[model samples]
Target: MSSVSVNIASKVQLVLRVALILVIFGWILDIPGYFGKYYYTEQLLALVAGLAATITLTDPRWGRTPARATISLVLGLTVFIAFGYVSVRYPSLQLELASAPPGAVALGLLMVLGILEAARRQTGIFLPLLLLALVLFSMFIGPKLPDGFQTRELSFSRLSVYLALDTNALFSKILDIAAITVAPFIVFGFLLNAFGGSAVFSDLAAKLVGKYTGGPAKVSVVGSAAFGMVSGSAVANVVAVGSVSIPMMARAGYARHVAAAIEAVASTGGQLVPPIMGASAFLMAELLEMPYRDVALAAILPSLLFYAALMLAVDFEARRLKIGGTSDRLELPAQNSDAPDKHRWRYLIPVGILIYLLFFANRTAGSAGLWSAISIIAVHLIGPPAQIWHRLQDVWKGLLQSAAAISDIIILASAAGLIIGVLNLTGIAFQITLQMLAISGGDVGIMLLLTAGLSILLGLGMPTVGVYVLLATLAAPALIELGIQPIAAHMYVLYFGMVSMITPPIAIASFAAATVAAVSPWRTSFASLKVGAGVYLVPVAFVTQPELLLDGTLLETATALTRTLMGIGLLTLAAIGHMSRPIPLPVRIIAGLLAVANVLPVSALPQLGMAAVAACSLAILAWAAVPARTTPSLKHENT
Candidate 1:
């Protein structure tokens, strides 16, 4: 609280911020061949800077007092020195380090503890605990297990070398992908919003869908989808778009919980869409060893189906509530379509460049992202001369913000790298696969359900990135072993992981949106589950048909896609129980059964037969209900 202490804290904060910027910039440019010589240096530098910032950011009650600042500096310096020594000394002394020199082992232990503390700081107890448990299991329990389950016993020196000195543990593939590919995209996403990209896209989305029945909700769906492409985090999506849409929906006469749920589900769906997909799409591509474009292409239809189902549910909700676009009932946000034409068109340039580079130029994802980030800066600088200086300031600030955002992910990915390292070292993934097979009796359906349940559970408390990583390594291999398409299996886990953002008990997205809408988090989360019912079904659909992932013939894909859409339509209606009037319970039940049959991975008997049954059941309900309900004219006059 003293002046000298305050100034010291301020200086430390500034230093950490600068370090963060340099770390991100270094990775993006791989400055002066550092990555080529010592890849771990670049990765470790980012990790260290992220941990430093997190310490400062989460400082004590005094808020970065001298004591806290001193602690942070010491911890950060120690990590930097440890990682620096390991990276610089290891290549030349590979054999010596492998022999368990006191210096190397001690440094490795420090790095491990630092990583564990960083994970605890960023994501809470679940992941760090899981990581520690894995490490303990690998070190102590593995050798005692039955012959089929036991891994080769590792000495302390050997485990330390693998975890800290080699590429197999802490510096594994997932971390490599995260640093080389995902971090750059995270920077690009932050850069887009720092420029005029967000406003431009919001205006464009409003213009495109702001006049529909549930105009504001639909706008949230559209805007969040686009924003999610860049942000790739459901929490970020909710904060960015829901800040505008949640209030707008409430003002348009939606219940507060309904408004919050709508925004929550829509933002969560952003991770399902491509080009950004909250970073999962890129990770999936890397894991599958496929081109990024192929991953995006396969994701296109399922993402569409996700939003299509959302749009319909929103529209039906609007009709059920009789919400409309009258001034008092609902109106477009004022910012939409109000920007000058010249400024608005600039938004498309970066997105167009990104698409061209990703699909046509066939650039590495990191390169594509770096170029896009540069293009965004370029467009901002080239804006109207009067705004250039101000825009330049915004870009500078954006660079710092992007660095801060990238740092957290670097920390997470590195910590997760530890879990992956242990899993590989102890052969735990194989053991898990075998256990899954045993529990499911080799039934693919049972395995899928169990995976879905496990994904949802992990997702409730973990970051989507971590959840996906765990599932991909442990659970997804089981699906692949059962003859599922590789992409289908991966996408299956990815979708369920994202759905956790809107699920009950701990729906992070719903909690965020509910705060914006002033609704109960519990109520909003349950409502999100209801509104996002299709999130649960779509993954199963793709897994069953594979055609939804474009893995089948054109005719077959089209036919399957059509039936699925019809099924989703009826499902939405049944879930909402509104079509002119609320549907009776009996009709709702029939509609539910019909929806399942239509989307079920079965032959013509259930698919066509259920479609016919649902149609008849709906007709009878409509005929009986319509006469008793108020006519449109009467309802309008009454309003």
Candidate 2:
């Protein structure tokens, strides 16, 4: 390609990125509605799709080879034309769906193809292949399959039109949630980070815990949790916090794999934290038709249990390896030394406004996010005049970054919407649900195991939002049918889906951290499994004890909380093979069993389980208090 052409492509890409952001902001502010007109959801979706297609094709991250660039440019332009036609004709096409014109059907096919290609570029072949298989099955392959697995057939044009233009498919509620609800939050996160809120979070976490044993690891936990409130991405959280914390841990005598694992596990839990969780949480709120606050509130206990267990695990691992505190803490790269104390209010005020609006003022999540972003800008404007130009540049960069991030999410959501459309149109989701129930013999425990396995399996190599959408469609209904609370059921699948980021063979977050820590990815993954064990078990706890989700009576909630906490504490100790010193194998086994018994809802002998848990807790405490016969050399202990 000529330099002129390349420069033109880049400029076009920039324009598309800016336009995408403006369109979303326009929707949020009801700019069109204020002008005595409104965007049809389909039209808005078409525009987003068109802009995303162009921006992604021009994005150098995917590839920049001349041949690839030429192909992408041609394909992108074709998609732009197709989407443009659809956006203009969608209102009339809706009325003609049963007998759509040949031109519309051809354009619909182009639109679907373009979206699948964009999805492939962003997420890899797995999701796009899955979507293609579903489409092929719905159109041609289903009638040949065996009973129960087979789907109803549709013509190619009809299927193409439905997938591309129907509100349920490419332009779905899932996409709506992504575009309107999740995008603003993404903008808020980017802007906050740009304005140094992330540094504030990390510094605060360090000041609070960096003097303790395994302080860097603990700092990772607290810092990741605080940053996770806004990031809501496992890999993003790891990259942002782990870049600093992982090296800090290594310098403090932690193994590379251990440091990577700590960072990975801590970051993955961000998806489960309240206020602004992963994009899937907003989908959950919409799917359940519940307030977003309810979802956040229900998530509080499980998230706390997860982090608490993680905190203990790291502390015990540090003791076992005899790693000492870093009294002279590692200097954070992003920390501002000039006015660290003065800028604290800037971070706090926007976050305070966000929380107040979401929980107390009863505002929409989108509105809350917009107000929060506005507050951050307002705060930045009031800062030192010398920094104003630099901060304004940061805001612009954040807007572009947010547009790129949201484009990928929009593509994934569109693909997920196709999956949902196929299931609903062909009745496969119902059949699969029934088959799952039959395979489990109608037992809730068996059903949960099946669901968890499937959720993890489906989640491999997929982002959390995509994983949650797939499981929510395929696995959640079966769990819900087994007499579980709806929120608990959804939360169960979400946890397992999110955990796949740290599970072996495809632990994306852990592997990313390993790259930074220069350790074996496999070792980091297994270590993460050990460190984040509670995340695996806590979902089952919540499913069985609705009290964990704040859905039960006060007494029931307290009792469940106590048992679950003890269970998590015991489990952490067993996994680490230490209390104050190395636990004997037999004692570890006993503690593990007691942990299981306590965590599981033993409805028939609930009191017995509590008694056993209490006994185990007392025994562990007593053992820890007893002095070691010979103090081991702390400096020489092997990692």
Candidate 3:
């Protein structure tokens, strides 16, 4: 594989590198686009970028496998031509779309096959093949499908053309979002990586937290979470900080799986951490047409609460297993070594400008991201590096990474379009929700539980934007039908969907960590479940009590935040079986129950009713931890 990578670096990667650069360069607007149409060129370039980068990233000897390269190249061409050919000629495209001409149908079917193949290569065959099966099922057996799943006989000819040309299907606005909006953030992340941001965060974490009990593990959590919020991709986050933190934890006497799980859970949690909780948040802001700041602020408390629970879990487990702190002999990397510390101060400029643009300047996220990218290049070129030539190369590299990142997301966007098509075609979204409500007997608990479960499962297999789009279009409507607030409903789905990266079956973050640590993927994912327990609960709390989401009066919101943080503490203690000392099983149960109770939506009086249980549980745990005279003397003598 390493030899293959070497081969790829020298050969087949050039075409993709050029495509990404061209696509990113086109964003600047000065370049005359392809054959008089820049839009076609851009879209084509974006498509080419995905294929080229995927090939380059995976196959070291990118061109060595002629079969893989040929297939990828062919698929790339199909997607570019299919979408570009139609979108540019949107009218004739619509005609083809409306009537489903055989030529167009043949084209669309071929395009779908290409996308499936491309997706299979990027993330493996599961998602692409599964989604393809669903598409096929919709086409063949749909009319004859059983109840709850039946649809009219899909006209293969018409459907193909419709799906191909209609913006609502394969080449939809979601794809546009991927191109215009999501691409820039990906660029920002690439630039951050090209510089020293990931390493900076990790070292900063270790400098800050690497000396306490279980310090390396804690640093892994803190650093990964901090970087995850910035990177937005679980796989990237794990690969970035886990490269440093995972090994650190293993060296600190933590088992490989446990260490990997810590990094994976924390890194995955970063997707939910605010002010920019994943790229999906940007999409949410656009979907709701809300200010990005408001969305970031809305995500603030929930992110903190989730991290609080994780931190507490790490702490308790550290105590339970007597995991020691970082050894003083551990070495620290120089903050700015080969990179030179001269521009160290200038590093703050781009980040500062980005923050200002988002919070005070009131720019659209797309505009803010564009300016931020510009600032990064500008500052590095003028202020610090002085090596204009080297920084230029950095810019080119960042552009390629940015473009390569687009492929997975574009497929997700296209898949989302198909998902939307399915829902609109069958009106199944509402029906499914109605059925869920009916199954739950209209009880909020059952309703929320089911909705959240679906969100997580969907989230596990999908990207942030895809997951939210799927759930928002499906489960959210039912919650709204039950009178949930719109923002609350969206946030509920968003949170669960984001956490899915760490959830089992398709836990991207865990798998990513396993790759870095050389651990069993399943063990890493399952262990992540322990640290990420609050991910399962936080979404429920926010939905049930919007106050926890800061939707009400300051006093109420403050109170809710406090209670929720406390609940996180209690839950963490219970889950890790440690509170000052090992908690007895019954007491652990009691604390957990109280924690769960505290999170439930309750009227004012009902809230107070649960206080007794919490207060009593705390008292009993404290009492139990009080060492008896005889036992205390024997324990001291033994020590």
Candidate 4:
């Protein structure tokens, strides 16, 4: 494409992005509260937003395919609208297969297909494929099937009726969470990123962590964690933070792949972290009818522990190679480097208000987000606040940042909708759960491995949130039935869902990081698995001691927290392959064994063993610290 055409295409894409962001969030938020008490508008809006997302994400290098795009978009909008509108508008008839028209039946299939395509474009094909498998089962399953696998019958009209009327299965609790909390938080993230809230955090992290060892990578982790708290999406975290941190890490002497992978993996961790975990936790609460805090509580330790592992791994690699910090000669820039210091405070105005809302005020997440945005922009634009026009421009830019992630969100909703609808029709969700349970032979460890594999499979072509939400719906029941606490059951699925992101063949985060790092994506992904191995152990940790999830008395929680911290420190050292200077491979392996024992559970022999290994590693490192006569304090390690 010529530069002019490319420029035009870019402009068009940006405009479409902004428009879809507004439509989706507006619909997702259901801002038309009074205007549309009717169900049709809501479903129709969802369809439009989903299609817009697919269109927006298409590689513009192919040029516009207006006819094809519009057809796909409209076909999708029609199906969902008909199902939602008709089912609500004619509920009695929708439930009666004999009374429904052929057009209505066609509409149902369209709704399923349209949603599948939207998901296919925005996420990957896994969800759509899964949804299709179940839908086809509903189409063909006859008598002689297992009890749970058998549905009412296989006629198109009958199947469509089941999908449309079964509100419990299709539109379920996820939509409720989406409307009440998740969507607003998504918008909150977008607005925060667009204006300058994230920029503020970046500037803050650079100042604080950038002066330390492994400064760039550490800064990425710290800044990404802070930013991830509100951003909601992992990939979005990369786009927002990686744009700045990746280049800086490379310039600071880290390999480009390592730099990018650090950002990607760190950003991915955001979905697991609180106060704003990947929109899934909120959905989990809604699904289980549990308190939101319950979800956050369960997630806390595991998130801290994962990042702890990451920090140690990165620090070790940096030290082993003696990668020095950025030349202090190049003085770091100020937070508001391009502007006056006065604007620095303006950025905090919003964040301060958000913190108060999230922590002390104890407001609903949606209300907190809305008010936070209002306060920042409103306070900044008052007569004494600042120039009204200038602040508006800044806020607008900030809002656009939020807009950019819309395509992915819409795709997620439609994809989730498809799975819910299809499985509801075939009763396949229950069957899948039952079969997996039977296969696992009632062992919790075996059940977890099965579900973990399932979660990863689901995650392969979908958003992490979409993946877990579906798995939690289908597979979590088996665990919950086996006496796993509702919270632990959901969290077990969530942990593996996150683990899937780091694992190939999907490895979305690793792939994103690889682009900036200049490392092969596969190699970086393998590195991710080794670094993120701690995550695999954490789900079991929480299950074994819910205290780690803050379920017990404060004292119990404290013990778990302390042990968790110790485990993290030990594991970090083990992962870095050093206690002091580089350890021999055998010693490193020995240290790894001791660290595992230390992290696993407290015991006299294992504790002594841990102490012995750590002490030995520390001693060796201490001796290395005493450099020979004129040798530099640092020495590089060979790869």
- The weakest ten consecutive residues by lDDT in model 4 span 327-336
Residue pairs with backbone overlap in model 2: none
Please, what are the lDDT tens digits per residue for candidate 4 over residues 194-279?
Answer: 44456566667667767767877777787888788778767767766777787887777777777777777788888878766778
How close is every model to the real structure, measured as TM-score?
A: 0.90, 0.95, 0.88, 0.82
In candidate 1, list every pair of residues with a backbone clash: 232-278
Model 1, 1-639: lDDT tens digits are 446655655565556666655665576686847645445453454354344435334333234456665665567557766766655565464677658777778777788777777667777788878977877887789889988888667777777766775666676676667766777777778877666466666766777878867787887788888888778888877877776777788888789899889888888888777776777787789999999999999999999999988888887788888876522222222222333556756867988898999999999988898888888778767745787667777777777666666667766777777788878777888898889988999888899899988988988768888889889999999999999989999999988988887887888889998888777999999898778775577888898889989888999899778767766767777788775577788877777776666666756466567567557645643553463545579768899
Instruction: Please give me the total number of clashing residue pairs in predicted model 1.
Output: 1
TM-score ranking from best candidate downward: 2, 1, 3, 4
lDDT of each: 0.75, 0.82, 0.69, 0.64
Error of 2 at 229 (Å): 1.5
Per-residue lDDT tens digits of candidate 3, residues 453-572?
898777666666778887878888888888888878888888788778888888887888999999899998898888766556777778767887678999988867766765666666
Write one digit per residue (lDDT tens) for candidate 2, span 35-142.
Answer: 899658889888888888777877654435667667777888788888887788778878887786687688778888888888888878888788778777777777
Score residue 187 of candidate 3 by CA lDDT: 72
lDDT of 2: 0.82
